[model samples]
Target: MKKNLFLTAIIIIVSIGTTKANSFKNNIYQEIKKDSARLSELDKFWTELSRTVREGDFEGYQAAYHPDAVLVIKQNRSISITEALDNWKQGFIDTKLGKKNDKVEFRLSKRIGSKTTAFETGIFYFTSTDSHGNPTEDYIHFEMLLVKRNEKWYALMENQKSEATKEEWKALE
Candidate 1:
């Protein structure tokens, strides 16, 4: 009889612990859902910015960037938003690349804060043919640190052109 009572007590304690754990998990899940919704909104803004880039709409892309934004190209180099825009414009003009088969796709990896900040990564695929009709592909990996400013999320810092592969993409998921 004593052994049975002890077993019952153990079961009761385990059940209570599981209930508490499940309650904590539910709270976390709800928080994550809220963050996901906010991230989705930010993702749309990022998508628009990418489309502007693909179309070579320098003005539109410039407008999306925060005035004091910094873009860090690999190797720890950083440039201001205006400088980056100028460089992009010059490159487009020099190459005469008129937005041929340019596409950008983004996926939300992880959201850190309460919709005030997010870490996102994505892939950009751009294709253009040379004078001899040779196909060219530019596949780039990009990451951005976004902050909510004036009720709008703006990318404060951006990093691009990392060695992006299919495996890396999968790992982000």
Candidate 2:
């Protein structure tokens, strides 16, 4: 009887320890999985964003940013968006005349800082025409901040800088 009681207590203690260890392992596994899942979700946004740009769907392109967003250019031109119905009007004008933003190449690097927030580093290469009607290419290195709100991802801020000291910044209110 004494031997049986001792064995029973030993089994209970071992079982408890095993259960705790497994729980800890599962938690760590979940965290690693969450990180990968977050990256995948963030990557999906770029796919959609590229599609919108390629299609020249201005509205779709605008949808990528939150409403009341701000855009700054070259650290000199800053614009706050509020019911910006004709915000991209100038770009449209240039495109209509002769200038074209016809091609783009996106190289994206994403990092998941949290379950609801992420950051992206990317280089965007744009092909356009020079003054003499020749093909010219320019690239911009940009950093972006994004947040998941209402189960949807939206860009909270985007800033771009070039070697020529050209900077473009966008923020949301």
On lDDT, the leading prediction is: 1
Q: Score candidate 1 by TM-score against the native.
A: 0.66
Instruction: Summarize candidate 1's per-residue lDDT along 105-145 as a digit string, tens digits.
Output: 56545446566777776765555554456676655687777
Per-model TM-score versus the true fold = 0.66, 0.65
RMSD of every prediction: 4.9, 6.4
TM-score (C-alpha, index-matched) for candidate 2: 0.65
> Judged by lDDT against the true structure, how good is candidate 2?
0.66
- CA error at residue 153 for candidate 2, angstroms: 1.3
lDDT of each: 0.71, 0.66
lDDT by residue for model 2 over 1-173, one digit each (tens)? 99999999999999999999999999999999999888888878887777654555566667778876665444555565433426654443454455555455566644647989887776766665534677766667766788888877888776664532124311110
* Model 2 Cα shift for residue 119 (angstroms): 2.0
